[model samples]
Target: MQYRMLSDQRKRWVDCLRGFCMMAILLFHTEIYYTGTSIIGYNLYVSDALYLFFMLSGYLLYKKAGMIDIKYKLKSVLRNLLWPYFIFTSVMAVPKALAHGERVDNAWALVQNVVTGQASWFIAALIVAEIFFVVALRLCRGNLFALGSVCVLSFCCSALLALNGNLVTFWQFGNALQAMLFLFLGYVFHRYEHKLVVDVWPTV
Candidate 1:
């Protein structure tokens, strides 16, 4: 059937995108480990995988949250994010903490790192960003102007923090702003999918 064929095509594209992202991240991290510098040629796009990642996550999660019960979604997200964070910090980071002779034990050390944005910080940040997204969506209540104003405010605050680094222990504040922007874009795209172009090469 046509539906089956379309589903298969989508799966293939998703797999291809996933593999490409994995390869790109591996190469970028490998380069960072070795040269401590640029990505040879095609530096801009190649080095910005995190941006792509954030946008895709935003888009997918927005679609999913719309489709399912938000409470269940929240529970699932917490379970998925927190368990790995705890394990990764405890198992992987505790050893490094021990080797470094830091006076903190595994649990306390993990808590400190998570709070300070030094250990599995992206998950923490993303969790906060998702909360913010939900809150904004609720408060805005389909008022695009209100949403846009809040986003503008978030961006301004983030830029201000970047300019003045005093008492800024975490970079994820700015990241949350960027995430919100991308998430908003995703939500809009979902809402307007019928109006907008959806093709291999999308317009606008």
Candidate 2:
């Protein structure tokens, strides 16, 4: 190990930041899912701030890959979702079948729902959202500027489409777009980490 500063401390920092982020996300999720109301407690603001810092994390972690193979990267990212998805399907199958008043004994139907991304779009959405910029970067040849442009365009498109909320493909899949926004933010942070931490406290 010739030299590496953050590498030694990376797990510590990543854990701290990730813990905070998870708390915020959990708060926002709980309030929304449990209440079905858009009411913002203190956690919503905290969640928003955590998301900003997450962008910084993305900037720091996602270094430019020199010769990334798009096919492999795509497959690799998707693979992370496979095992959990199967688990989700198996667990939820009986409950969903029972609720539907269908033959709850049909294991095949439950498996079909999970495998096809129908029952677990949220998990699928989060997985793909995290990979959006990675995939985009692969297509863009790892150009930071190009990646940032996609991020900005995604934000603009989101804002413009927020009013209608039906123009974009797959926009109906709950919070998938929000997840993609995080991925894009990661790209931005990865590109601009210096400005972020350097200006965090403003040296005296």
Candidate 3:
């Protein structure tokens, strides 16, 4: 396959999509935080939007992850998750624990909160998913396409199992699989993004 760099305009579009995704994420968090005040669709719509964001997140961060060397990419991945995790969990856990007169066990669990850090189990989920996906990628020797599809199906099945137990319904996925997907999508975009020129832009 031949490789060609993206034009200025298309890069701008990816940047715009990224910025929009960030805002959507923030809005979801904000609404979830304020959901106690009877804000309409605060929990529902915002949560749903966050799911879409997760589903598409893999499609988004692909390029940056893919273009870099694999070892470096793996390091980048760990660094991204670990540092903020350590810092935030350290910063927030003790005070909350003190307020309630009981420590939530450890800094490890606090990092798992979906609402504050990412969610109740998002960090754990992301780390698990990332590890599996990266291992698959390494074994397959860059068969990211095959490995990514498998990761998607595997995570979705886990979601199904979570549902069967009467746990959180729908929206069971997160950025782990998305990281792989977004990486592949970046490769695809870098490959065929020229096809994206269209008649008009649509708004939500």
Candidate 4:
């Protein structure tokens, strides 16, 4: 009963955190659009909120990691993420192409952007990251060291890509590589939550 209560409390806090991150992101974008600069001056801090979102997603999914079916999960990911991405990108493409037809070259180029995930890049990156997480978890088979190694490798690859001017954005895979590290870290945190001390503030 006590364990159940603790779990519930943690969930509530996690939801609050997610909401806070969402607001932060909205504010950051709004500020940039209106003023051409962040009020905080350091714009990256709000960008980190996106990483927190990735981590929170992984943390929540940790419980289901063991039960993941690769085929089913892949289908679900595609249906949920890819389908929406396509629909929205297609909707936006009509206007963009109409507005700048001369610069667009051809319809195939727009299709290529959708395929490469340059259309709505974050969703593409997330799709890849989630798939990578599922595969890594299956391969690691509950081995923390193996999982950590995979996360580290992903981070290194992402860093290298950035250093080399990001030669490939296919499916936004380079961004996904970086997201994998935060996702794994979130999963680790949740997996060991009972061993860690987390405090709730009533005043806030």
Of the candidates shown, which would achieve the greatest lDDT relative to the real structure? 4
Off by over 4 Å in 4: 1-4, 64-67, 94-108, 198-204
Instruction: State in Å the error of residue 83, model 1.
Output: 2.2
lDDT of 3 at 168: 36
Higher-TM-score candidate among 1 and 4?
4
**In model 3, what is the error at residue 132, expressed in angstroms?**
3.1
TM-score of each: 0.73, 0.62, 0.59, 0.82
| Model 3, C-alpha of 199: deviation from truth (Å) | 6.9
Q: What tens digits encode model 3's per-residue C-alpha lDDT throughout 1-204?
A: 123233444556556765776676677656645663435555555555444444444444444444335576568667987566656656767665665466676766555553343432455445445555556666666666676577667657655655677333222244354444444454454445457653233332
Candidate 1 or 3, higher lDDT? Answer: 1
Pitting candidate 1 against candidate 4, the one with the higher lDDT is 4
Error of 1 at 129 (Å): 0.8
* Order of models, best TM-score first: 4, 1, 2, 3
CA lDDT scores, all candidates in order: 0.63, 0.60, 0.52, 0.81
Taking the candidates one at a time, how many backbone clashes does each contain?
Answer: 0, 2, 12, 0
Q: Considering every candidate listed, which one attains the maximal TM-score?
A: 4
lDDT of 4 at 115: 72
For candidate 4, write residues 44-147 as lDDT tens digits: 66767888888987886677336568898889888987889889998887565655443565889888877779887778888889999989988988788998
lDDT tens per residue, model 1, 63-138: 4334434576678767886667667765767665655556554577567776565675556667666767767766
